[model samples]
Target: MLILGAHYRLAFTHSILAFSQVINAATHYQLDYPDLALILALVRGGSLARASQLLKVDVSTVFRAVRRLEAALGQQLFEKSRAGYLPTTLAQSLAEQAERAEQALEAARIGVEQGGEVISGIVRLTCTDSVLQGLLLPALAQFMPNYPALTLELSTSNDFANLSRRDADIALRLTRTPPEHLVGRRLADISYRVCASERYLQSVNTTDLASLTWIAPDDFLPDHPTVSWRRQTLPGVTPGYRCNSMLSVTELVRAGLGVAALPDFLIGDGLRPLGEPLHGYDTVLWLLTRPDCRALRSVVTLFDELGRALKLP
Candidate 1:
């Protein structure tokens, strides 16, 4: 009985000692070099010899960096084989943290050098193709002159831009209700009218919905007022031609393919609005962003400029 108790006590004490050592080792390993040192050396420099030359350090210095990184991580972060020092599972898991750290560090460096200077960080805006054509480009042309140092990168995608995820700094959307976790401001209650080319008016009568050929956008947005009107009024109606972009739809309709319902902003000077008014086709344009980005100067400026550009006389 005494021997068994002693053995049990010894095992428990050793387990506690092992756990304490793990915590101590983890706390002691401090990384002094810049973030992504190991990964950058491995990817860009290719081998230790080339990496050391590029990093302006000795080969053993690079080796020690790898060792220190592994020690800091308290894991076998890499393995030496005939091929090279291959990263272990833990290194791969920490990849995103390293990248994020590098970005934060870059932001810090920029802040230090450009302190009290004008705004200069790149502004990434997410906009729909339609908004890009109708609102963003013209607004940007006018707004950019005011802020010379700020750079703009417009990302035009139909997918909902998750502002919290940094998908875009700002977005222009048409919605009656703003989504949760987003800050939305109503810009305009945008109206549209049915219009067609003069050639099409001469060839076909578009006074009524039936027996009138129409050109429509290829992808149907469920919330689109015109699309909803068409589905509600003319269920079996199929257009002669369908294209994705508003530009394509306008061009196809202008070619006298068929009459199309278009926003006045998208219409050229030549096209005439039809007399017949479609119901359930008025929508409100909105500017939206995550709360954090909404406070950003770039996004707020975009909202202000874009809202001004969208108004029609």
Candidate 2:
């Protein structure tokens, strides 16, 4: 009886160990193929609502795919929140490679088909909201008209798109150096200034940068990306009103609520640009891609066209 019990215990232990191995493999194993990339793209697109609307699928379907993705990978891609699901650390890291691979495959297909080789796909592009509005919109309008067959999948988020994980096929980043092992170009300089509505400016406490309330990102968390950005750019300045929505911030600013740092593109008819830029700060927008697909004809065509379209000169 004791011998029998020992054998059963050993069997149970082996089963448990095997299960753990399977879980680990799903979480850490490198991902390949386009379906995973597409699902990942949808998740990266934004909130579940936004992703669903953009994907032109039911939110329930998106949720199902998300569940299946998690189940198959044996890992949680996002942390559940009342607002929506937020990506996890693992998701952030892995996203770049999947994005790059997806890009490579598409480029290969495009090259093949355009040269009598088979091809058809959508290109995933990631860029800042500011860049998308100010620059990319016009460029895309022109590019799309020419390539009626090609689809442009654009993802605009404050989060840095991970090129290595394949978070984006092409990314317009406001940084000098691209991620390690990726190829990129420092495209142009982006500048921002404190702006306010004339009505609001008239009622302000002062025109001086120091003596006024401000519209800024919420600083509830220490690691908040926007807070970090604000601190780096405007240290010692306190944010009077903090909110997450860019539209909200702009609307508040437009209502003459307070002076806020805004990009040149965000400066519209009702609002006005301050005399001086915020701390005289500027960021470089970079065009990034994986080294593997750098030489592909389709990739080259995109880079050449996009580069020309986004030219500063």
Candidate 3:
């Protein structure tokens, strides 16, 4: 009984020492604490070479920093294999925490820069080609001069900007249904009309619109309002030219390739409206922002300005 108790006491003391070492390593890991950026770069870049490129550092520097971090933490943070350096579970958790910390830092920095009085900093705005070129640019010509400290980054894409990912501060989307996660006001219903160049109209019979060769959006964009409306309204009509880009379709129509459904804003470029505006093709233009984005002073100011400009008669 005495021997067993002595062995148990020794084992218990050894376990305590091991636990203390772990705690010391965690608390005293000074090099690891500030190297959260390095950790995130490594995980996101997937390899030392990639990480070095992303961080604009020498590969040796990245390797040394990671080595120091691992030594300070007293554990392996990644597994090296033929594929690449895959982050361990601990490293994954650290990267997530680092991301959160980075976001917080950015928010604080933005706040300090704005100083509550000045409406400044970059406001990323996304929209389709027609909205960006036709409507928003003209409004911005007046809006930007008034806010000299503000910077606007415009991204034109057909795909909806993912506000949840912070892809853009604001998005001008043409849709009947906007995503529920975003908050915004519908600006106005964008009108769509069938248009053809004067040169094309001379060749094709205007009386029988269904018999004319059409310039259509590609099958990939079956959900586009113009594409869907065409399919439903004009049965048995096929396109002579198919394109995925609305801007390209407009250019094709202007070149007299075929008649296409186009927005009213684009009609002045040597393309004449065919008939009355096509039914079921008009979609509301929405100015959208994430809940967090709506709180930013610069974003709020720009959002309101864009809303007013778009709603004007």
Candidate 4:
């Protein structure tokens, strides 16, 4: 009876050990470093062209790598549709794991480089094209050279990037309200003015704003605050030309094509103010950084410089 009991106990112990070994083997399976790199690059880039640029490889290479990964995984990582490569649940999980691995590697590298007193690292920033061209460019010129060891990656997009996913380290946004997840300072209250070229104004009745030809944002920017403001301020008025780009709208207005509500910063020597600044169309500028990133020396330094420079008078 004792021998029988001992045999049962030994079998149970062997089963447990086998289970642990299986888990360990699955978890520590030799990961293909190149495939991991490709996955991370594609996930971050959002498109093939962008991924190619990031990976310094051709589009075909990216396509081949993605196909190979999908085949090996025996599951579709991304949905290929008209909207482009939308990540599947599996892809998200894989990408997140890859990100963690990359972060660990970066931490190791930074740990090794800690001997240097200089604050040196990469900081990714995202903002609208207008902000990039008008506000951030000058600010970066001053801030970047001051930190010779730091590198900046600027991404321009009309829509907000997902900061929680580390899409960017910081964001410069114009909004009446900032996102709850982000931590930042309200930099300024931005306002837009009704403006047109002198020649354009002469061609229309400035006294009756509703009667003037206007250039406005197209369907692409359906939720543009100006669109609602225009509808309320000038009922029955439709724009003479529709464009997606604010810069293009300004140029069209300057070419005597139509009048537009141009932002205060963009109102320069060429345009003449027609009316008092529009109400209910004002938005505040915010310089935002993730809570986790605020402690990083490079992020804090750039945040301070931008805060000082972009703050409203």
Candidate 5:
């Protein structure tokens, strides 16, 4: 009986010591929220320069913050190599926890911001430049005046904004598949058509499409549907002009510079459709927001308004 009782005491003592060590470690590492944010961004970005861009700080600032974090923790969080900074196992675990904390903090902030009865706050919207000019801005011009207290900020980028990180409150994107985490619906089916100015069509032989001067998306957009379509359908034909911007290609088509494939919605005023909508190149336009932000009055109002205005018949 004495031996069994002694064994139990030994186990209890070890448990207490282990608990104490955890407490001591926790007390030793006094990590700030901003530090945690930096860690998360670094893990996501995989480079100091990219992290700095995400955090809106200088590269030196990001580097110093990382060094400070390592000093506090007494361990390296990342493996630096020529390729990029790779997160250690410990860093990945910490970043996961930090992400959860970030989401909670963002939820709380949204709750407080929406607590007031007035639907007034900034809603940051992000989308590609073509979508901004061809679709959203026109609808927003009509929608914004209705909400006098609200402010709408726009960000144009080809890459989808990271909605999980609250990079933007709302996003309008053209994709076959929208991120599952975002709350939204497909607004419209985007179809492409061969388009040119009426004068260009009259000037060129309509019977031989391969012989006409073609305007194409530049090598920068090699993966663009029109680029692939032109390459596959027309084979040996070469374009007369190439542009990096889809909007610019549309403008060139309207100016009679050359014929180009354009989304049906962009075939406005001076442009005329030369052929039917292309097959297997249809994409859907989506209006999306973080699930947490969907409940915000301002976001909800703008989301609904944009949905209604942008939905194609």
Candidate 6:
């Protein structure tokens, strides 16, 4: 009976050892959070292009991530086809787990953001150059000094930053319809006016609208309101100058180069509006932030400050 008990104890010890080895081997390779995020995106989107779009990365980036994950796991996660990448069963399963982890991480982030009275950390904001120079910079100059610990970084872009991907913590944009996913309210109506310098107005026959030299946005800005407005307002008349930047157009008008439609916010000194705000080029200035970040103290504070400072009287 003593010998039988000794044999049973040896077998139990071996079983425990084997289980420990299995766990060690399983945990040897640490899965990257970025790779897991890519996997979840691919599983949800079902294609490399779709995943890239959702992740705000290049298609090659997603492809390389898949290869890296497969190599680390020593298993194939996806099968390539003409239709796109089809996730294997393991990929789907892992994605499900990763989604849960992602949710937990997001909740954790929100909790940390709302945890304290401290309004610190960097807040990234994206907007057009004109808005930065004319509207936001001044307001920020006054507001930022109050919060010494908080840092505000600005990125100027012609296109809207992808808030879902966290390209910027906040965005100030001029649009007729703001994106549904973002949280914000319109600050004020953005009105456009036909403006020119005193010198240009004096040189041209103001009475003869067709004969005056005109400044307009170049073909690169095909979707710009000025482009469409010019096409509709002056069918055959060619512009004297063309520029891709609205700020540059404003400068040209200020230099007495020609007349152009400019946003009301950009009508600084040295430029005068030739007429009342144009009829069809109505837009609004929207102050937007990610829904997840709405509760963040820094974001909330800046958002409220900008809303108050920028609201038109």
Instruction: Pick the lDDT winner.
Output: 5
Name the better of 2 and 4 by TM-score.
4
Q: For residues 1-313, could you state the per-residue lDDT of candidate 3 as single tens digits?
A: 1122333344334433433343334456543335778888999999999999988999999999889878877878899999888999777876766654554344434444555334555789998887787788888987777765566888887766556678898999888899999899988888899999999988888888789889888976789888888889887898889997788889999998889999777787689998998776788888999888867888999999988888845
Write candidate 1's Cα lDDT for 145-197 as tens digits: 76555567778765555566777777777666667778767877767778888
Q: Ranking by lDDT, best first?
A: 5, 3, 6, 4, 1, 2
2 versus 6: better lDDT goes to: 6
Looking at model 1, report the run of 10 residues with the lowest lDDT sum: 1-10
State the TM-score for model 4: 0.62
* TM-scores for candidates 1 onward, in order: 0.60, 0.56, 0.62, 0.62, 0.60, 0.62
After superposition, the stretches of candidate 4 with alpha carbons farther than 4 Å from their true spots are 1-116
Candidate 3, pairs of clashing residues: none
lDDT of 6 at 25: 63
**RMSD score of candidate 6 (Å):** 14.3
Q: How accurate is candidate 6 locally (lDDT)?
A: 0.77
What are the Cα lDDT values of the candidates? 0.65, 0.64, 0.78, 0.75, 0.79, 0.77
Residues 1-313, model 4: lDDT tens digits: 1122343344334433433332224343333657667877878887888889989999999999899777765657778777667887666666766654554344434434553235555688888877777688887776676665566788876666557678898899888777888899998888888899988776677778888888998988776777878988787998999998777888888888889998787787879988787888888888998999988887898788889988767
Better of 1 and 6 by TM-score: 6
Q: Each prediction's Cα RMSD?
A: 13.0, 14.4, 12.7, 12.3, 13.1, 14.3
Candidate 2 achieves a global lDDT of: 0.64
Residue pairs with colliding backbones in model 4 are none
The clash numbers for all candidates, in the given order, read: 0, 14, 0, 0, 0, 0
Error of 6 at 269 (Å): 1.8
Candidate 5 off by > 4 Å: 1-116, 162-165
